[model samples]
Target: MASESSVWNTCNYSRDVTFFYNLVGKKISEEWSTQDFVVIGLGLTVCLIVVLANLMVMAAILMNRRFHFPIYYLLGNMAAADLFAGIAYVNLMLNTGPWTRMLTKEQWYIRGALIDISLTASVANLLAVAVERHQTIITMQLHSNMTKRRVVLLIVCIWVTAIIMGLVPSTFWNCECDLDDCSTVAPLYSRRFLIFWAVLNLLTFFIMVAMYARIFIYVRYQSRATSEHTSEIRHNQTVVNLMKTISMVLGAFVICWTPGLMTLLLDGLLGKASHANSFEKYCLVIAECNSLVNPIIYSLRDNEMRRTFKWILCCLCRKGADQRRQPSVKINSPLSEETLDFVQKSEDRALRKPQDSHDKDGWTEPRV
Candidate 1:
C-alpha cells in the first residue's frame, strides 16, 4: 500500500526532496535497523576527516611565510575548496537522511552551489599548479615571474568561472513537474548542460596528462647540460620527482571522482539516473573523499610541508624532557665543542642564502 504522504504516490512537489527516495529500502527513520545507523555513523566519520585534514593544510599554508609563492598559493586555495566540499557533505547527509524534512529550498540550493564551487575550484587550481610547474621546468627558471597582480587575476577567474559553470545552471532547479504535483526529480537544465560540465572536467584532465607527459619527455630525453654530468644528473632527478608528484595527484583525482563522473555521463547520455540510490550516494561520497587526498599526498612527499605542519601545531602544546631535568654545569669535550661550532657556522651560512625555499635549481619558491 502506498503511504498517503509519499511524493510518488501523492504526486506532490511541496514534500521534502527525500520524499521520493526509498531510503535504504526502509519505510522511514523509525524503521531503520542498527546497520543503517552504523552506515550513517561511518559517513559522518568520513566527512569529519575530510574537513579536519583540509583545514590543517590550509592553516599550515596561511601561517607559514615560506609557502607564500604561487604554487603553495594555489595549494592553499585548493585546500579551502576541499574544506568547503567536506562541509557540504554534512548538509547532504542531513537532506538525504532522516532530518530531510527540515531542509529548505534555499538550503538545498546553497548545498548544490557549494559542491559545484568545490569541484570547479579544485580542477582549476590543480591545472594552474601543473601549468606553473611546466612553465618553470621548460624555461629552466626555478620560479616563474608571475606577478602578484597576475596571481590575483587567476584567482578571480577561477572562482568566477566556477560560479558560472556550477551554480548558474542550478538556478533552474525549481522541482516543478505536473501542474498539480510537481517534483524535484527532474533535471533543472537540459542534458547538454550535464554533458558540458563533464566535458570541461575531461578536457582539463587530458590537458594535465599532456602537460605532464611533455615535462617528462623533456626532462628524460633532452638536456643541454649532458656534457656536465653532475648538472645533467641533478636535472633528470628533479624532473623525475616532478613527474612522480604529478602522477600521484592525477591518479588520486581519477580514482576518487571517476565513479560518480561516469554515472553523471551515463545519465546525460541515457536521460536517466539509472543507478540505485544507495550506489549513487556511495559514489558521491567517494568523490567527496578526494577532499582529504591532496593534502595527504603533499605532506608525505614534501619534507618542507611536514616541518610547516609541525611548526603550526607545536604552539598549542609543548612537551619535552627539558622541564624534568635540572641543569648542571656539564662542559663539552674538545671534539664535541668543535662539532657544535661547525654546525653553528653552517647554519649561519645557510641563513645568508636568499629564499630559504627552492628546488635543486636554487629557485626562491617550492613546487606544489
Candidate 2:
C-alpha cells in the first residue's frame, strides 16, 4: 500500500534480516538525536537508582536478624525482583539505544520474555505479601510452619508461573505483528494477547485490594476494643500505621503500572501495537519508575529501616566530609536528633511489642 520508493534503503536486507518495517513501509535506522540521548540518559539514571535502592533493601534485610521472618523474606524477594527488573532495563536500553541496530526476530522474542518474567515476578511477590499478611495478621495465627525451605519453594513456584505466563505465549501464539505477515498494525491474535495480559494484571490488583480490605475490616474491629490503657493505645496507633502502609503500597502500585497497562490495552485494541511510538516508550518508562519507588515506600516509614538507611547515608557522607578537611563536623554521633528519635521510637514500640517490627512497613501486627 505504500509508495515503491518508500520500501526502505535496504529492502532485501530488511525483509530477510530485520522483518521490521515502519508504518510508512520503510525501516528506521537506530540513529538518535540529542533529545534521544537526553531521554535515554534519564532512563539509565532511574535504572541505576532502582538497582541501588533495591540492593540496599536486600542488604538491610540480610544483615538484620529481626528481619528473618516470613514477611521480610517476602519483601526481600520483592526487592530482588526489582533488582532484576532494573538490570533488564539496562539490557533493553543497550539493545534499543543510539548505538543499536536492527534486531533479529529471536532477539525480539528474548527481550519480550525477559521483561515479562521480571514484571510478573514482581506482581507475584506483591500478591504473596498480601496473602501472607492476611493469614498471619488478620487471622491471628499463633504459629506458622512456613519454614525458609517452604518459602523458597513458594517463591520458586511464583517464578515458574511467571516464566510460563511470559514465554509460552510469545513462543506459541500466532500474530502477524511479530511474524512474516507483519506490518505496523497489530493483528487480531496479537491484540487479544495484549488484552489478556492487561486483564491478568488487573485481576491481580483486584485480589490485592480485596485482601487489604479484609485487613482494614479486621483493624476497624480492633479499633473499637482499644482502651485508654497505654498498650491498647499503642495497638490502636499500630492499626492506623498499618492502614497507612497498605494505602501507600496500593497507591504506588497503581500509579506506576496503570500507564503501561492502559497503553497496551489501547494500542493493541486499536491495531497499532507493533509500531514503536514514544508514547508507549514513555509509558514503559513510568512503569520502570515503579521499581524506583518501592524501596522508598517499603523502607522510609519503617523505623528500623529508616535508621539503617540513615546509618549508611551518614557513613558515606562522613567519608565525603572528612575528605573536604571538615574535622569539627559530627555526622556519626548517636546522640544526634535522628539517632535519638530512632532509639526512642524503637524503645517505645519495643515496650508494647518486641520481636519483629519490619512488618510495620507491610502492615502486620500480632493482635487482630
Candidate 3:
C-alpha cells in the first residue's frame, strides 16, 4: 500500500508528472481485459502493415538508381519518416493503456519524443519536396540542378530540426513549474507549446498549398502559351504529371492530420472544455492511417514507383522460391559474387525490356 501511495505521489499535478490514470481515468492492474487484448491486437496488425509498406517504399527508392534525384530523395526521406512513425506507433501501442501504468517518467517522455520526431520529420520532408518541385517546374527544367552533396546536407538539416522540435517539449517547454499552464491532452506538456506547435504546422500547410498553387498556375500558363516544339510540350506534360502525384501525397497528409492538429489546438486553447478526449483516439487513428496511405498513393500515381515496388516484391518472391526448391541448376559460389552478378543481370534485362520509351530520368514512360 505504501508503494501504491508512492506511485500516486509521483503523479502529483503540482510537480507536473503524469500517472497513466490521469489520461485514462481508471485504475490499472497486472492483467488486461478482453477488450484491451482485442484493441491491442488490431492496433498491432495495422502497425505491422504500416511498417512493411513503408519499408518496401524505402527499399524501392534506395535500390533503384533511377530514383536518385532531389525529388526522389525527398520522397525517400518521407518514406523513412513514415517508417519511423510506424515503429513509434508500435511502441506506443505496446506500452499504452494498462502498460503505461508501468512506465517511468523518463520512459514515458521517450515514447512521446519518438512520435514527435516522426511527425516533425514528415512535415519537414513535405516542405522540402514542395520547394524542390517548385524550383524545378518554375525553371521549366526536367529536374533541379541540386548536387548529391547539397541534397544530403538538406536532409541532414531536416532531421536536425526535427530532433530539436521533438526535444523542445520535455527539455524546455514543459509545465513542470506551473499546473495552470499544463496541457489537457499531454498533462506534462505546456498548453502554450501545443498551441505554438499546432499553429506552426498549420502555417506550413498553408505555405505548401500556396507554393503548389503557384506551380500549377505557372504550368497552366505555359501549356496555353503555344510552344512550337513537340519535345517542350512533352516535357511540360511529364512535369505536370509528376507534380500531380506529389499533390495527391500532400492532399492525403492534410486530410489525415488536420483534424488531429485542430483537436490539439483546441485543447490548448480551451483546456478540458474542448472535450479533446472524446475525439483524441479517433484523430490519432486517422493520423496513423496516413502513413499506410502514402505508399499506396505512390504506387497508384507514379509509374516508376509502382514498377520499383513490383520489382522488390518479385525479388522477395524469388528468394522465397529459391529457399524452398532444390539447387539442381545452381553454380559454384552461390553465396558469393557470382550469385549477385546473376541477380543484377536478370534485373537489368527486366528493366531494359522496353525500347525508346524512357522518361527524362531514364524510367520507362507510362502509357498515355
Candidate 4:
C-alpha cells in the first residue's frame, strides 16, 4: 500500500513538469518568425523618409518669404507635428524587439504617450487649417483682418488643445500594457474625445466640399449665362487651384487618420484579438506614411513652391544654370534724365492721392 501511494505522487509531479515545459516551448515557437526583420526594415525606411520630407517642408516654409503667410504658418505647424510623429515611429521601430522578446513596461508607456501626442497634434492642425480656409472663403472680410499675430495665437491654441486631448487619455486610463515584443496600451477613446474629433473632422471635410461645390456651381452658371470675362476667368482659375490644394490636404488627412480611428474604435468597443496585430501594425504604417505624402502633395500642387524646390536642388547640384540665373548688376545703374523726370512725375502723382505704405511699395522707379 505504501509503495502504490509513492508511485502515484511521482506520476503527478512528472505530468506537471511536462505540461510546464510544453507551454514554454509553445510560447517560444510562436515568438520566432523570419518576417520580423522585413517588417522592421520597412518601418525604419518609412520613418526616415517621413522625417526628412517633413523637415524639408518646415525648412522651405521658414526660408522662403513667399511662404510667409497665415496659411503657410498652419502648414508649418502641420509639418512640425508630422516630424515629431516620424521620430516617434522611428524610436518605436528601433526599440521594438522580436515577438519572442517582450517590451519593457517603460517602453509601452512612452510609446503610448508619444503616439497620443503626435496624432492629436497632427489632426488638430489639419482641423485648424480647414477652419482658416473656411473663414477665408466664407467671410473674405474676416480674412482681410487676419494678421500674423493672430495666426500665431491660433497656432498656440491648437497646440494647447491637442496636448489636452492627449493628456486626457493618459489621465483616465493606463497608458501601458505588457505584450509580446511590443507594448499595447488602452487608448481611452472618450466619447467626448471621439465626438469632438469626429465633429471637427467632418465639419472641415464638409465645409471645404460644400465651398468647392458652390464655387463650381457659380462658375457653371456664369459660363452659361454670358461670355466669361478675362478677369472672371482668372479669378475662377485661382479658386480652382485653391480647391485642389485643399482637396489634397484633406484627402491625405482622411487616408492616414481614418484607419487608425476605426481600429481604435474597434479595440475600445469590442476588444482587439491577438490575430488583429497585423492589422493594427498596418494601420500604424499607413498613418505614418502621411508624413511623407504631405510634402509631395504640396510641392507638386503649389507653383511657387515647385519652382523654389527646383531652384534649391539646382543650387545644391552646383549647376551652371543656377550660376547664370543670378541677378544682373545693371539693376543698380543710375537713372537717365528722362527716367528721373518720369519718377518725379510719378511721385508727385502718388502724393496727390492718399496712399498707404503697401501701395507705395507697389510703385517702382522708371527704368534707365
Candidate 5:
C-alpha cells in the first residue's frame, strides 16, 4: 500500500512538471507578429503621453509662482507619482523583449518591486490630496494653520510608507515564481504582508472617498447660498473642478485596484486555478496602466492646466521666433501722454495731506 501511494505521488509530480514545461515551450515557440508590434506601440505611446503630461503639470506648478500654494503642491506630488509609475510600466513592457526572449528572474523581481512602489505611491498621494482638500474646504480654521512644512512632512511620510510596503516582498518573502513566458516572484501573501496591504489600501480608499464626498456637499451648500452672478459662477466653477478632480482619482483607483482586490479575495476564498493565471496577469497590466491614465485625464479636464500648458508652449515658440528675428529688430523707447498723466496723478496724491482718524471720529473740545 505504501509503494502504491509513492507511485501515485510521483505520477502527480511528473504531470505537473510536464504541464509547466509545455506551457513554457509553447510560449517560447511563439513568434512576434504585427499584432504584437501594434500592442507594444500602443503601450509605448501611452507611456510617452503620460510621462510628458505629468512632467508638464509638474513644470507648470513649479515655474508659476501663483501655483505654489498647497493645492498645487499636492498636484505636483500626484504628478510625480504618476511620472514614476508610468516610467516603471514602460520599463516593464520594454524589458519583456520581442518574441522569444523571456525576462530574467532578477529582472522580474526588480520590476515587481518597482511596480509595487510606484502604484502604492500613486494611491497614497491621491489620498493625501483628498485630505488636503477636505481640510481646506470643510475645516476652514484648520486650513489657516496648516503650514508648508507640515505638507512637506506628510509627503515625506507617504513616500517612506510606500517604500517600506514595496520592500516587504523583497525583504521577507521569496518572490520567485516561474510563469510560462513571464515570471514573477512577489512575496507570498503571508499574514503580515496581507494585513499590511489590505489595511493600507482599504483605509486610504475609505478616507479619500469620505473626504471628497464631504467636500462636494460643502461646496454645493455654499454655491446655493451665494446670490451674486459672478461670485456664483466662480464658486460653481471651483466646485465643478473639485468634483472632477475627485471623480478622476476615484475612477482610476477603482479601475486599477478593484480587479486586483477581487482577485486576491477570490483566490483566498476559492483557491487558484490554471485558467485564472492569464486573467490575473491581464488585470495587473490593466491596473498598472492606471498610472498613465491620470495625467491624461487631468490635462483633458482641467482648464487651468490646459491653459498653462498652452501658454508654456506658446512662450517657447515665441522665444524661438524672436531668436531667429533678433538681428532685424531694434527697440526704441517712447513715453506716452497717458504714462505722463498717470505720473502726475500719483504726484498729486502724494502731495495731499493725510486725514487723522480722530478728526473723522468727530471728537470735539466740548466733549473733553
Candidate 6:
C-alpha cells in the first residue's frame, strides 16, 4: 500500500530525491536477519575504505606543491566528490533495510537527498574535469592558465549546480498528490523526473566521450607532426598517457553507472510491472562500487599519483616508527645562517623556472 501520510499527501511538490530504491517485497523484520547484518557489515566496510582512499588522494594533492596546478586541482576536487559519496553511502546503509520503515517523511527525504547530492556532484565534477582537459589539450598546453581564484569559483559552481539538480525533483516534480504517477522504486518520486534525470546523465556521458575522442584525435596528429622534435614527442607522449588514465576513469564510471541508470529508465517507463526493484539492489551496489574504483584507477594508471601515494604511506610509517624510538638530540648547525639563506634562494629559483622548463619532479606548468 502507498504511504498516505500527511507528509506525502500535504504537498504535491515536496517529494525528495533518492539514488537508491526501497525494498519492495519484504516486510520490515522486528529483528535484523543474518543477511541484513552481513550486508550492513560489508557495506560499511567498503564505505570506510572509500573514505580513506579518497582522503589519501586529496591529501596527496594538497600536501605536494608540485600538484598545485590546474589539472591536479581538478583531480583533487574529484577526490572530494568521492569522499562525499563514501559518507553519503554510509548514511544510506545505516538507514536502509529495517531502518527504512521506521523513518519519518522528513528523515526519508534527508536520507535520499544526501545520496542525490553526492551523485549529482560526482557527475558534475567529472564533466567539469572533461571540459578543463579539453580546453588545455586542444591548445597543446600541459594545463590551463586558470588561476586559483577561478578554480575555486568553478568548484563552487559545480556544487551549486549539483545541489540544484539534487533538489529539483522535490522542488518541482513529484507524485505526492497522485499515487498513480509515483515510481515503484521511489514512491515519492515522479516517473517523469526519473526519466529526465536518467536521460540527462546519459547525455552527459556521451558528451564527455565525444570530448575525449576529439582530444585523442588532436594528440595523435600532434605526435605525428612533432615526430622529429624529440622533446615535443616526449611531451605528446606524456599527454597521451595522462589522457589514457583519465579515459579509464571515465570508462569505469560509464560501465558501473549505466546499469543503474537504465534500471531507473525502465521503471520510469513501465511503472510497477517493470520489476525494476528486483534489480535495484544489485544496480545500486554496482553504482556505489564506482566510487571505490576511481582511487584505484588513479593510483594504478598515473605514475605521479602512484608515487605520491607511496610517499604518503611511507611518511605515515616513518612517523609511527619515530614515535616508538627516542627523539634525536639536536646538533649545532655546521653552516651559518647566510649559507642556509643562499641554499634556500637557489632552491626557490629552480622552482620558479619558466613554464617551458620542467621542475625537479619533471612537471611543467603550461603558459596560457
**Candidate 4, superposed: residue stretches over 4 Å from native:** 1-32, 99-106, 139-144, 175-228, 273-275, 318-368
What would the per-residue lDDT of candidate 1 be over residues 1-368, giving only the tens digit for each residue? 35644646533346554443332132335455677678678777888998888888887766655456676677778787788788877776656545544656556566667777878887888798789889988875444689868887998898887787666654653333322212122233334555566777877888987898888777666555563665455555555664576578777887887777666655555543343333666678789778878888877776556655665455334334234343553432212345435533443343224334442222111244
Each model's number of backbone clashes? 1, 0, 0, 0, 2, 0
Candidate 4 local distance difference test against the native? 0.59
**Number of the top candidate by lDDT?**
3
Ordered from best to worst TM-score, the candidate numbers read 3, 6, 2, 1, 5, 4
Candidate 4 per-residue C-alpha lDDT over 15-91 given as tens digits, one digit per residue, 9 for 90 to 100: 22123223223222335356777888888898888888887787677755546667778888998888888888887
Name the candidate, 3 or 5, with the larger lDDT value: 3
RMSD of each: 8.4, 7.7, 7.1, 11.9, 11.9, 6.9
Candidate 2's residue-wise lDDT over 1-368, tens digit each? 46655644323333422334443244445678787778778888999999999998887777555456676777788888889889988878877753333666556666667778888998898898788777766644322447999889889988898889767644666353344333232221255677778788988888888888887788677757656567665655664564566467667877888778776666555554444344667778788988888788767557666656666677579787766565565543223566555665655563335455643322223222
Which 10 residues in a row give candidate 2 its minimum summed lDDT? 180-189
Candidates 1 and 3: which is better by lDDT? 3
lDDT of 5 by residue, 208-273 (tens): 777777777877776666646553445355545656665776778777877775555444333334
| TM-scores, all models, native as reference | 0.74, 0.76, 0.83, 0.67, 0.68, 0.83
The lowest-lDDT stretch of 10 consecutive residues in candidate 6 is 15-24
Candidate with more favorable, higher lDDT: 1 or 4? 1
lDDT of 6 by residue, 210-251 (tens): 999999999999999889976676677767877887788789
Q: How high a TM-score does candidate 2 get? A: 0.76
Candidate 3 regions exceeding 4 Å error are: 1-31, 323-361, 366-368
TM-score of 1: 0.74
